[model samples]
Target: MKHNNKYERPKIVKQVDGLMNKVGRPALNKPFDKIDNVPVDELISNFGSPLFVFSERTIRNRLNDAKNTFTIRYPDTVFAWSYKTNYLDAILSIMHQEGSLAEVVSEMEYEKARRLGVPGNKIIYNGPCKTRASLERALKEGALIQMDHLDEIAEVEEIAKSMDVKPSVSLRINLDAGIYPQWNRFGFNLESGMAIHAVKRIVLGGILKLTGIHCHIGTFILDPLAYKRAVEKIIAFEKELESKFNLKLTVLNMGGGFASSNTLMNQYLPGDQAAPSFAQYADAITAPLLSVQNSYSRKLILETGRAIIDDAGYLIATVIGTKRLVSGYKSIVIDAGLNLLITALWYKLQILPAQTYKGVVEDTVVYGPLCMNIDCMRDAIPLPDLQKGDKVVIKPVGAYCVTQSWQFIKLRPAVVLIGADGSVDLIRRAETLDDIISAEILPERFKS
Candidate 1:
């Protein structure tokens, strides 16, 4: 396969005129009812500024998209919800209802999975560091524990020896997927024969049982071929292990890197253009493994984090003010900042107005409530003329939004789950000073 250097255009530094200005009313007339009923100002007045609003419709739609991809391909495929993506109980409940098992990294997340009622066998315990207690709990419950490093593998072996039962384990593999230049951190190095060494350690250790192999190349992967290449590499590696150790691999775990619908601004066309749909990803990852003529039959498992939840969330904010840049660009300042929705800062975000075009079209920028100098939302976005208070909707933020949010200057935003029947429930409340101070134990001398 030849690499196409054509897509590598330098970042679009210069601004283009508003789509409405270039294309006129038709562009503005694209239905805005999705944004109409839930006005940003109304939400701000009711729930306050910098509110995080999520759509149940988007969640179900994207979930179905991912599930359909695998269901259509293989008879036995399991999707473990990567809890690190967005662990909000409401969101996890949705995935649970959709038949997704939990994939957790930390003791907190493992406990969260148990609390969510995910069966012990359904959970995949992943991460480099694990406390002995967490390991004991997960192993006792019969979870699929994926080992990250050699030290962790040794710890698992020691813990397994202490247990009445042997824990089922899998070794994480790092392969040359051809897309990411940085795949060395998470899994065992495949090229360096470290993965083979780890496999031997697990097999000969006599306490931990090797059940699967796992790898995650990169995140928001736009190219389907990258996954195909990864699948082929993993299959070849799987064959090598089976031949050397005489172990029948029970499952092949491909850690998730599927891209969601949200547009990465660096992308030439929006993320939707380059973003492979769930079905495309399923085909890419499954084809290579299934293609092998006489390989051992193993259950294909997906530990998808972002693709399942990224589109389910919406960050609704009120436009506090609007400013025209000195370079003739437009900006819209909002209540939410990088603290609550950090993905916006990491990826180029798509901005949308709550209501249809009743006002004139203009360029705009969105700002959050943080006082830091680096705080920004979207720079040079094109939107309609606005007043002091107007509703704005920024989307495809379901994954990595709430999970990574920090309680900085302002309290974190309220997360509301809008149900399929239009019923809204507050899954998480906005942070308060009292809530902040609750964790503090003031010294006697400092007490007023």
Candidate 2:
């Protein structure tokens, strides 16, 4: 295919005044127009427009890179896939195949991991809302339960006493790690001495055994030095407890909030340039942990979500229509909306055209098919002229969106996985009208 570098001025320019002010043109350089050797046009043809395509090769490579980077620095390391990020069975299977443990927050997610044949010992349950029944099951099945609050400690004590079994448990501690907007709501506060008190309550009860101490200071943490601070604090706490309580906390779960290559809306530079590499983060965390002695050696656990799978997924949508606003600005609507691609609200998702075009770039407002006014993807993005049927691919959207998408306004679309051998598999089918109404039981008078 021959490239088009020639540019022609657009015909839609109308002077606002006798002396019109010139508008600045934004850059429109795209990295690539195709995905995994498949053109965006052919993907929309084989599947439908507004579809999701995942690269299994990309997922494997990223996970492998993360594991190797950490294991080389810290010998005993484990990575648990954050279930809430993207918990489709197919996605979970890929993570499990790569030897990732399941780290889930809710009861539903914990059950999903179990249903997929994941062993109980391989599951790390983290959250504040695990019911008593869920706690009972987790204890019996040997799942590592990271207690979030003091009330949960009482519930676990009752369950452990009834079963006549001493279950190994961990406490989720929240402390200052030089990170802003601390996540204190999810775990016991270490600064206020609540975490130590909770541990003493459990130890005094003698029904539960303290096995580990875990902390997830914040999310989307960009500074690797922050991890060093967190690790140092956790190790200090470990040593203090060993001296005071004479107990060993074996596992130290420095939870994950690694940033992905999706440019935040507030960011000035592109994410590929701004985000830190895995090796950098590994260095910050492992450097502090390698100083531990042989007897107190703790297994480091990570639950990285977005960084592993964001760049591996793509959302393909076609141009539904185009129009010119009254202000002479160009606007194009696509089939995808906030309902499908929620990342549009936070990150500037990169959209690339399927084919080449020859024209001067203009600032275009991208809208979704929804009737609401907030269904906008990109504002004032520079692009060439687009037709009604032009297909485009939005990229690096593989995290959080899939599991958080709602069945509102429009039905959900299908998700396909592209294998390492170039095979395309439709792992999830699109939703239908019957799916919406199947669970509804209409009253006799309401039934037509």
Candidate 3:
């Protein structure tokens, strides 16, 4: 039997101790050509390279799964879409359509939510910094203000007094949830008596009504038991608050820190295998709430953002060049960079070939098209020989990349949403030179 052979240029290779030879190695390349049945090539041709593609079906399904997972365990579960995670109007609209309240961390995010038709009452206003004007507007609109410090309480009280309205607010508590690097910066400290002191001050002020309690342990939390500990601490504090002030809280906001299925840079296993499922998180959270539900029913508000949106997003980039380093290692450069995919710093995002190929898999270093050395995406990844003009899909970037992305050497790319019915919509258009300098004003002398 005769087999067809392709000619190739032979290169010298360095032999490393205990390393397997590349010969006879099975090709690990698999084509990821389409997103929701929409061809990747078609998308890049219609839009451009380095495009952001989101699956509307994935977003809805993930949100629905989260809602169902918690609602079945506890009927009072409420989901608030964390705006800081990915505040793209289209994403927010989808979240709102799926019945998620807006959870904002800043005045800008709060305004964005309001502009999207989410009433002030439906907005969960959080964060360490809240301006006077925003606070006033939120109070007037009956927003759920989560007070971060005693100063915010004073500010809110003053505003409430001026408006002649007693706004029901929630206190953000920061506690030692048996996790490393405790997040005690944003909220009142629980162990240091700061939380109790803040509560006392709120009650003593008598200007604002304290109706709820909120806490966010940390982001990308892997341990379910950590949440269990947080819930236990919150429940205990709630009891103390109720007993001391004869005030029963109505809402317990276990803030968003849910881990998405994107592998952390330091993780040994992939995110999907290591991270807890929605069911596990629901059980850990609802178990404690269910135990005390008989005494007083409380609305459980979950401001989960990453877990629901991360896996739905994909970044389609084009390979521009390939090279061999001094150490005889292969390197591939793509069009997308740290400017467009900021989350690449924290996540070891999976990169897949857009077309099927038969080639030897090598440990290749993936670099972004940037002059800076820090623009490298993957330090070392096992990938087949990727040539110029080849398309690659980098994924699970639906959470923070867009929200945190900024324009640097290159303008930002366009983002499109592939709907459940295979319809494509351009949610955000690619940035142009005018878009970058539109707000800039040249000096009179310079203009002349």
Sort every candidate by TM-score, greatest first. Answer: 3, 2, 1
- TM-scores of the candidates are 0.90, 0.93, 0.94
List residue ranges in candidate 1 displaced over 4 A: 1-27, 30-45, 293-296, 325-328, 356-360
Backbone clash pairs for candidate 3 read: none
Q: Sort every candidate by lDDT, greatest first.
A: 3, 2, 1
Q: Which of 1 and 3 is ahead in lDDT?
A: 3
Per-residue alpha-carbon lDDT of candidate 1 for residues 326-423, written as tens digits (9 for 90 to 100): 56566767877888788877677766776655655555677787888677877756677766677667787888988988888878878787777766
* lDDT score, candidate 1, position 139: 82
lDDT of 3 by residue, 114-167 (tens): 999999989999998999999988998989999998888999999999999888
Candidate 3 lDDT for residue 191 = 97
Compared with the true structure, all predictions reach lDDT values of 0.78, 0.86, 0.90
Candidate 3 — which residues are off by over 4 angstroms? 1-29, 293-296
Clash count per candidate: 6, 0, 0
* Candidate 2 C-alpha lDDT tens digits along 1-448: 9999998656575332223234322434553567898777777778787899999999999999999999988879999999998999999999999999999888899899999999999999998899888888898999999999888988998998899999999999999888888778978888789887887888888889999988887877789899999888888887888898898888988888898999889987778888999999999998888877773378889999899999999999889999988767889999998898888998888877766765656778899888899999998666678889987788888998888888888989899998998888899988999998899999899867
Candidate 2 global CA lDDT score: 0.86
